[model samples]
Target: MLTVQEIRELIKVVDESAIDEFTYETSGETVTMKKSGSKAVAAVPDNGAHTDHPVDPVKNSQPNIQVEQTEVSSSDEKPIVETTADFDHEIVSPMVGTFYASPNPESDSYVTVGSKVEKDTVVCIVEAMKLFNEIEAETTGEITEILVEDGELVEYGQPLFRVKKK
Candidate 1:
């Protein structure tokens, strides 16, 4: 059996690490802790294996939305462009897996920056549980930016790309 001091030390070490989850088992002791990152406003008891401590549910709960608005005068010496952040974001890949841009190595990318995409456009493919899942762009617009890299592990509801509403 592991002593209380041993458990405390293990928890401290796991808490300091960047890994989201950790686990340990001894002859008569087992402990696990899962960290939820910096976006969770509150932590609830998740019915997974790790429940020894309350995990902070910050970064993985909801997307932190930000809107910025800028105004420009019409009658000015220079033609000014105003920026109004009134667009909606299309999040994709609601699973834990690797995201790929193309179907294979020798295929063209599904979408790119400045590419106009319609609803149901296959933006990317996510590989989960050894199965390929094609992720589509839920909204229609020009892909302004891709929020993730090719062959990257994506979290649930992670913003895959930014679309400027048309």
Candidate 2:
């Protein structure tokens, strides 16, 4: 049987990872965790049996763990770009990964707000599945705004930088 602390640690790891669900079974105990938007629902079946039907662990005196997402947003959620007048071109992420502003921790950032860049210039790096991919400035422009921060997770097609075309 897993202790409460051990299970909580596992939940933390799962919440941090990109995985949406995790299940572990040993002996007769079964623990299953699922991520629902900003909250995590963790349950341990009272009977220690896997079933297709969902049950309320709280009603059965089973352990229930709820973890909140680390990132928080305002109740009035606003779009990143309110208007097209702010920029002429957008440098979108090519893959889902962690964004890096510089080549390494000790190096200066590849580009900053108002920095000029030309086609084929390496602007940043995206790390996915242990591979660091160099993202280029496919269009010539001056960076008007950076849409994402260093080490933030970005999705495919998500805008990373807004550029004013030269």
Highest-TM-score candidate: 2
Best by lDDT: 2
**Root-mean-square deviation (CA) per prediction:** 16.2, 15.6
**Span of 10 residues, lowest total lDDT, candidate 2:** 53-62
Give the runs in model 2 whose Cα sits over 4 Å from its true position. Answer: 1-85
Per-residue alpha-carbon lDDT of candidate 2 for residues 55-129, written as tens digits (9 for 90 to 100): 111111112334321121211222345446478888877554567888777788999998999987778886543
Instruction: Tell me the TM-score of each prediction against the true structure.
Output: 0.50, 0.52
Query: What is the Cα-based lDDT of residue 79 in candidate 2?
Result: 35
Task: Flag clash pairs in model 2.
Answer: none
- By TM-score, how accurate is candidate 1? 0.50
